[model samples]
Target chain A: MTEELIIAGFGGQGVLSMGKILAYSGIMQDQEVSWMPSYGPEMRGGTANVTVIVSDERVSSPVLNEFDSAIILNQQSMDKFEEQVKPGGVLLYDPNGIINPPTRKDINIYTIEGSKLSREMGNTKTFNMIVFGAYLKIKPVVKLENVVLGLKKSLNERYHHLIPLNEDAIKMGQENVVSILEL
Target chain B: MAEVKLMKGNEAFAEAAIRVGADAYFGYPITPQSEVIEYLMTAQPHLTTGMVVLQAESEVAAINMVYGAAGAGKKVLTSSSSPGISLKLEGISYMAGAELPAVILNVVRGGPGLGTIQPSQADYFQAVKGGGHGDYKMLVLAPSSVQEMADFVEDAFDAAFKYRNPVMILSDGVIGQMMEKVIFKEQKDRWTEKELIEINGSWATTGKTPDRERNVITSLDLDSHKMELHNHKLQAKYKQMEEEEVRYEEFMCDDADYIMVAYGSSARIAQKTLNKARAKGIKVGLLRPITLFPYPTKVIHKYTERGVKGFLSVEMSAGQMVEDVRLAVNGKAKVEHFGRNGGIIPSPTEVLDALENQIIK
Candidate 1:
């Protein structure tokens, strides 16, 4: 199966890096993957997005229009990507920044208080990991073990000490995600 | 050394160049391709293999630096984006005229002037038809994926030296910016002084040997007859390349009714569209030109005889390669063009729709 995902948020929210980590995890599982970012000025301080495609077969187009899933971290990302999720697919979002939640009834929608949970953990930088936790819990595309290995490969050795905390954030997300639809 | 790693396309290109033991690299900074120079500078190949990496003042200066190094019998390269590459056209022409062997990487972006920083295949005509003055031809290699981005560096250099002319890696922003798993080549040692003297001694300006006649590397011939002979020599070399160096990939064309012709990033997108069209009970295939200059014209012509009904040339430009497709078809079948220029990448759905509306209709 091919999982085409779009992760979007403000530039500093680690949206691109999150997609990179996911792609690396897919690679670790011997899957063909591609990570393509919406680069240039949009990555400076504005909303940035990356398209990550992980497949059991060769990935054809790294750049895509619609996606099987959309991970929205902010309202702007939600406003743009809500309609892009394929029917009967998945939509995961952070409730903190979203004023109007997704209204798509055909797809499965889930919410995680990732920003608030990460803030409560006294580390706001772990916001994306928290969201990723919820995503894996819902979709479970790549194994959790592979995600940890991906972190080890993607992060510098100096940052390796914080892997446990990031893991904890992911667990917190997995435990806290509220599914809004069964479809 | 034959290791597998997930790397960005630009960084992989830089690493592959180092592994291939390139003697020198001169480049100016530009979006989507700046990572190439950055990675080379950070890796500092000079300390490892004595490979010199210098950031030139401008694209013109960078290409000229490559010309100078290539004249001295060193394997050299330079890279830039569309507008920056435009600035290097004069130097590129001079290198071709003088028969200097060099590799040029164009991580193409949208352009007619200073266009968007996004990906584009708009430079197809400029790259294959000669971007500068003179009736010259440079071997053009179009890489469709990050893996090809790395693999083509060595290929480009080899082709450049084989013909004693410049070669271009005609990549677009998508191949330059995307990240994917790549298997790197094993390291090769740089050429020794003895090897250089043996290989390039005949015409290289490597400080004229004492036992041989003084060699001069130049394209200038004042006499009309001699200049015409030089032109004929270049044309003959180009004809040889066309005969021997044409490279292409055909996917699902055994019983295809329609074919999509594309290169670089557009080719990747076309593959996806081909899959979609096949699922909808349409017999569509993809013909990707790996070498743009020595185009896959003969292969395309072969399809015409095999009952292929129509051809769709998809690009990131406003119908540049479509003309070539039309020529190859030679009135045997219909040929149509579909594209999204000015940095807008056409989606698979749009391409499929175009095939249904333009070609099938």
Candidate 2:
């Protein structure tokens, strides 16, 4: 199976890092993966997105127009990518800054209050992990254990102490994700 | 050491250079390829393998540095984006004329002059057709994946030294910035002083021994007849490389009626388009050229002889490689070009549509 995803948010919101973690997790599962980011001037405090692909077979193109999933963190991303999700695909978004939520009817739309929950927990940086957790809970493309291992690999040795906090955030995300559609 | 790690293509290229026992690297900072010099500077290969990594003031200085180190028979390299590479052309021509061995990488960006920082194959003509002034050629290697990005550094160094000429890794921003799994080869020992003398003593400026005359490294020939002889020698070397080193990969082409010719990232996208076309019952195939300089001309001619109905050259340029494809096919088959320039990468659907509209029709 192949899962092509786009994760977009502000530059400091860890959107690119989340995609990196997902790509690493796919590698941990011995699957083929590619993580491509929108680089250069577009990444400076602007809406940054990364295309992540995980497949059992070789991934053909790192660039894509349609996605199996789009994890959007801001309204600008939602406005931009909502229509690009394929029919029956998943559209997961954090509803904190988004004024106009996804209006697509063909895809499965879900909301995770990642920023709000992370703020409540007094660690706003855990927002991306929470969104990622919700994504795994909804799709379950990769196992949760591999994501933890992926985190260990992605984070530097000094940051290993914070893995549990990120794991807790992910678990919180899994529990609080609200499904808005059946299709 | 057989360690597989997830690495960005630019970083992996730097690590591979260190692991391959490269003697020196001189480069200027440029987007999409800056990580190569950054990683090298941070890793400090000089501390372990005695490799020198210097951030040159400009691309011009960097290429000249490469020329200097390579004149001493050392494995040296420099990398930059399109505009930076343009500045290095004069030095590149000098290196080619002097027959110095060096590896240069152009992690290409969209360009006429200072174009977008996004990926582009627009540098194909500049890379394969000799961007620098004079009748010269550099062995160009196009890598589609991160693994090839790492692997080609060693291959390029080997070929550069083998031919005593410059070699280029013509990658783009997509391949350079993308992250994927890469397996680094076991560390190779740098050439010892004894090995350098034994291997390159004949032509290298390794200090004069009492037994032989001093060696000079130069590209200048004041006499026109002497310059013609030098040109003939370079052309002969290029001919030998063409006969021996043409490398390409064919995907499902045995029974294909239509062939899509692309290299690097364009090739990767074409693979997906080929799948889509096949699903629609179109007999499409992909021919990816691994070596752009020794461009698989014979294989293209073979397809023409096999009665392939048409050929499509998919690239990120206006129509560079298409010219070469048309030249290779020689009007035997209908050859066309499909592209998205200025860093706009063509989507798979667009490529498929181009195939249907331009070739299949």
Candidate 3:
């Protein structure tokens, strides 16, 4: 099985790190993975995006024009990646700063109030883990145990104490995500 | 599995350098590849492996530092992007003329000037055709994945010392910035003083001794005849490399009608194109050249002789390696170039469309 995903948001939204964690989880499950980010000056505070591919076989390309799923955090990303999602794919987004929500009709659309949930959890930094957890819920390609292992691998040991909190955030996302359209 | 981890390509290369027992790393920060130096600094190889990691004031100074360390029989390395590499070219030429063994990395960006910081394979000519001023050819290895980014570090050092020539890992910004799973090889210990004497003592300016004369390292020769002889010697070593070190990978070529020749990140994209084309009943294949300097000329000729219809040379440049592909084909098959400049990477379907328009039609 292969899953090509794009996670996009404003800089410092943990877009790249979320993709990195997903890639590490793929490695934990003995799958091939690649994470390609749109980086440069635009990353100062502008929109940032990353393409992540996880596959049972060797991944052929890291850069792609289309994605099986899109996790959009900001309006800029939602507007940019809405049409890039393949038909019959998933488009998950947190309606935090989004002025223009996705209008695609051929793909499944899901919304999670990531910002609202993270604020309620008393940690705004857990926003990315919430979105990531919601994405995993939509498509359970990797196991939750593997996701925890991946978090351990990607996070520094000094921050290991926060893994349990991040896990709670992810679980929150999985439970609170609302499916808007299923075609 | 031996210590597999997901790492960015530039970081992987830096980690591999420390693991492969490189004596020193000297580099300046540049966009898309600054992580090479950043990772080295954070890892503190100087404290862990006793490897020196210095952020030079400039790319030129970094390369000269590489030359100095290499002349002393140290496994030295330096890395930069397109503009920075241009600054390092003179020092690179001097090292090549002096026959010093060093590893240089050019994580290329789109350029004629400062250009875009995004990924591009525009430095193919600069890399394989000797970007520096001299009659020299550095062994160039193009890595497509983070794994190879780590793996080629050991291979490049081996080739550099074997030929007493500079070796370059020609990676683009895509490979430099992208993250992938990499399995590192066993860590190696740096060369000892006695080992350095045994391995590179004949020419390296290690030290003057009572039994052995002081070794001199210089690229300058006032005598024209002597300079011509030096050029010939360098040419001979390049020829040896061509014969022995050409590396390439072929996919679905045995029964294909068309061939897409690419390297590095372009090759990775073309592999996806190959799959798409095959699914659509188009017989297309890919031949990815691993060593750019060696050029893989004979292999292209072999494919031509085997009745491949045409070749589509995909790069991230206006067209550089395409010229080499044409020369290798020798008019045996039609060769066309397709690319997007200014740091835009073409998609798989776009490449396949170019193949159909430029080659198949």
Candidate 4:
């Protein structure tokens, strides 16, 4: 079975980081994974996204055709990718960033007050972690311990200091989904 | 010679350049070819061996730096992918026009624009026929393996110096990324540069010395007779390189009925295709080119004469190698092509299927 996910938003909204966290978690679980971000000039203000595929075997291409699940952090991304999600796929979006975004009754949609929850958890940028927590609650691709390990592996010297805070944020996301959404 | 070590093609070029004591390396970053710089970054430049490394602002600047370094009587090298290489053409032509000696390593990727980053041999024409303007030829070397990438360093520099011309080591993403064992020869310098450009002293400007004016290295010859003589001299060097530097690898082709020709990463896959054909009891063999500019035309024609019925030229590009195969076959053997472009690498299974269509089916 293929577990494909696309995370999109404005460049600095932590969308790519969330996608990479999921991808690295996939890797930690011994699942085949591929992650590629749009690196062109349009990345600054335009929607930036990462396509991630996790599977049981070697992935043929790093590109995605139809996403099995997706997340959007900004209004533009939500509007752009609203219809791109596969039928019966899962979609998680930040409620604060989107207004009048179309709702699909056929697919599962989660509108989380991600930024608010992140601020409550002591970091405003941890909205991505909240969504990650939501996805993990619904589809546990890997264990919580494995996500930590994956994060550590992907961190470089420059970002090593942020690891503990990031882990706290991920735990907050995982816990917030349970207490708030009853997920 | 040294013991074999598994290496990727880009790293192989890096090792080879260092082995050749290249005075400097100037380049810009692009995929598939990025490993060239990555390797150099990991293996810092050692100045004592005459290595100077710099990451240029752009490919244009990189190649132009090559022009300057080469003019300084220093052996120099640079590398880039398809689009970046295209940007370097103006400087490349300038290098050619001025008859500068340097090695250009291109880890080719699919392209017309900023295409997908995949291995392909589509740049054969641009490289061999001269990517820049005017009637000139650069000695182009197409290496099929990491080993060849390493080995061709001497050949590349030697040929460049021999002809007072620029030489290129053209490889693709497959060759660049694929890891394989290689045997590196004891690093040797074939030509000692008296001065990067002054090595060939027909210069109108060098440095004003007592008894000598200056040595200016350029391609501008206003007088027709002078230009003709210069052209003849360059042509003579080309003829010499054709005789001495043309190289290729042949397999079980002597009594084979069908032939396949390819190079770089595609050639490696073609080898596997030949194996699959042989397993099916088909008398098929491969003619893999190691040198692209001075293409191995004679060797291919040899197979044609020995009752070879058909040939298939496979590549990542649409039909770059097809033209050369047709030239070699010269209507004697039926030729077909199978390929993909824009960074899509052709698979061995696909090539075997094509072989079946033309030869078996």
Candidate 5:
């Protein structure tokens, strides 16, 4: 099985790290993974996006025009990537600052209050983990135990103490996601 | 089992230098590749392995430092992006003339002059042809994945020493920045002073021995006749590399009607195009050249002789490597070029479209 995903947001919104964590999880499950990011000056403050591929076989293209899923965090990313999702694929977003929601009719659409929920959880840094957990809820490509292992691998040793908090944030995302449309 | 981890191509290349027991690294920071030096600095190979990592004031200084270390028989390397690499071309030519064994990495960015910092394969001609000057050629290795980024370091060093010629790992920003799972080879021990004397002592300026004449290293021979002979010797060495070290991968080409030739990240995109074409019942294949200098001309000629309808050369430049492809085909089949420039990566669908319009039509 191969899952091609695009996670997009403003710079510093953890879009790249979200993709990184998912890629690490894929590796922990003995899967092949590739993470390609939109790098350079635009990533300093403007929109940022990452294309991640997790596959049972070797990945073919690290740069792609379509995705199996798109997890959008802000309005700019949603506007840019809403139509890039493949037909019958999933579109997940955080409905915090989105002015226009996805209006597609051929795919599944889910929303989670990632920004609000992250604020409530008192740690905005776990925002990406929460959204990641929501993705796993809809598509359980990897195991939760493996995600913890992946977290350990991706995070520096000094940040290992916060794994439990991130785990809780992920569980909250899984529980709080609202499926608005499923076709 | 070896160690496996997710790593960026630049970082993987740096870590492999240490693991391969390279003696020194001298480089100037450049976008899309600064992580190479940053990783080495943070890893502190100097403390652990007695390896040296220094940040030079400029690209010119870094390449010259590489020349100095290599002339003394040290396993040395330096890395830079397109612009910085341009600054080092003179030094690179000097090393090629001097028959120095060192590795230079060009994590290429879009070119001409201080172009964008995004990935581009426009350096194909600069790398495989004579980038600096004269009839000199650096053995060029193009790696498509992060794994190959780490894996090719040893092979590069091996070929460098075996030929006593400088080798170039011609990567681009895409491979340098992307992260993927990599399995590293076991750590190798650095050569001792005695080993260096034993292995490279004959020609390398290890030190003048009392029992023998003092060794002299120089690339300058003002006599035209002597320089002509030296040029002939360099051409012979390059020919030997072409015969023995030509490396490439052929995919799904046994019954293919059309073939696509690409290298580095362009090859990865072409693989997706191959899959898409097969899904549509088109017999398409891909030939990925791992060694850009050797050019893989014979394998491409083989495919051309097999009556393939057309050849598509996909790249990230307007058209550079396509010239090499056309020469290889030698007018035996239809040859076409497809690409995007100025830091844009061509999509697989667009490449397939180019194939249909330019070749199949």
Candidate 6:
């Protein structure tokens, strides 16, 4: 099955990097992927978003209409993309950022206090990894080993020291996955 | 050996053009495509032996410099975004008329008047239909990946020389900024001393042509017949190119119940939409055209005979390639269109919905 997802937030939130990690994981899995982001001014805090599509076959479109899943890193993201998620879709929220939580029963909503968790993990930047972990527990697109490989492939060769802690963040997030769907 | 590295489309293009032995670069800075010049500035890009890089006064001056350099038979290139590309059209027309060889790159952005700086496929008609004046066509190459962005550098140069024309690499801002792993090939061929005859010899306008013959490269043939003859010659070249250069990617089209037609960055979007459609057992496939001018007409038409349902032309423009799709489909299958101009991208959901509403019906 092919999974199409969108990650949205303000600029400098590393939304694009999150997509990169997922896309890289897809590459390691031998799945076809295309990660596309808004260019120019959108990167300057004006509602940044990226769309990543992973499929068993060659991907056709980089745009998505009905998302199987989404990661809302901020309140703006939740407000904007709340209408687009498909029924039976997965919505992972950072509880510290989202102002209005979802009240949908047909879809799965996971609210993780990623900011606190990431800060405790020694680097708030690992918020992305925490969300990735939750997705791993629920969706499991890539094996843990392959994901580490993808991480090394994406991370800077100079900053290899941060790899171990990022791995811990993923593990922690995976264990705390929140399920908010009747189904 | 040319080492391969993961690079953005813009930087890779600059690297590729320089590697292909381009002797001169003339351009002004513009977003999305700004990295092209940015990379050039990092390391002075020169011809293998000797080349020149001139940051022109404006897009107009840049294209004119291209006109001058290419007229002299020197490998010259320039790049810009949609607004800048529009300014270069006049120079593009001049190049076409003078039978000059140059490579022009358009890192497309949303347009119509200083549109958004985002990636856009909206310039399809501007590149294909000759956005400039008079009767002419630019050999437009639409590259979807960083690899093609690199590989097409050589192809564009060769195509320019082979046809005595200007070639444009029409890329969107997304393609320009997106980074990917690329494997570079060994570059062994380069412009030899023999290739510099017209550029460095007595052929250029040095006022010395009067002794040999007037080296006038003008399209103002007052005689309609002579001008018609020239036009006829360009037509023949374009026809030959269409036969030899039509390139495209056909994905899962062997048994597709329906086909989607898209190009450049939009084709990538189409790929994602096809996957979603396929998961629902829709039997949808994609036809991604690489060469915008020498469009893969025959390959796209092949889908019609075997109950290929219909074609959905997804572009960033209103409906340029849609016309070509209709012509290729030839009433065998209905041709529909979906577009979002001014820098907006059509969501994959919207496209699938369009496909369901227009084609699957």
- Model 6 gets an lDDT of 0.81
Candidate 1: which docking quality band?
Answer: high
**Per-residue accuracy of model 4 over B1-361 as CA lDDT, tens digit each:** 3544535667888888887777789999898789888888778866446577889999999999998877766678899989999999998888887888889988887777787676667787889888898777888878776678888887898888777789998987766764444667666552354543356545423345677666677778889999888778777877777788888888778778988888776776677677768888989888878778678888888777887899988887878878988998899989998887776656567787889886556
Q: Clashing residue pairs in candidate 2, if any?
A: B1-B186
Model 4 DockQ vs. reference: 0.04
**lDDT (tens digit, per residue) of candidate 3 on B267-302:** 999999999999999999999999998989999998
DockQ of 5: 0.90
- Model with the higher TM-score, candidate 2 or 6: 2
Lowest lDDT block of 10, candidate 1 chain A: A38-47
DockQ of each: 0.86, 0.85, 0.88, 0.04, 0.90, 0.39
TM-score of each: 0.99, 0.99, 0.98, 0.65, 0.99, 0.84
The clash numbers for all candidates, in the given order, read: 0, 1, 0, 11, 0, 14
Winner of 1 and 2 under DockQ: 1
RMSD of each: 1.0, 0.9, 1.1, 8.7, 0.9, 3.9
Residue pairs of candidate 5 with colliding backbone atoms: none
Which pairs of residues collide in candidate 1?
none
Candidate 1: stretches off by over 4 Å: none
* Residue A178, model 4, lDDT: 31
- lDDT tens readout by residue for model 6, A64-148: 6668888888888888787788898888888785668877778888877778888887788888888888877878877888788
Model 5 lDDT per residue over B255-285, tens place? 9999999999999999999999999998999
Each model's lDDT comes to 0.93, 0.94, 0.93, 0.76, 0.93, 0.81
lDDT of 1 by residue, B212-276 (tens): 99777787889989999999999999999999999999899888999999999999999999999
TM-score, first chain, each model: 0.97, 0.97, 0.97, 0.87, 0.97, 0.93
Instruction: Evaluate model 4: give its TM-score.
Output: 0.65
Q: Is 3 or 5 the stronger prediction by DockQ?
A: 5
- The C-alpha stretches of model 5 lying farther than 4 A from their native spots are none
Q: What digit string (tens of lDDT, one per residue) describes model 2 on residues A108-159?
A: 9899999899999899999999999999999888888999999999999899
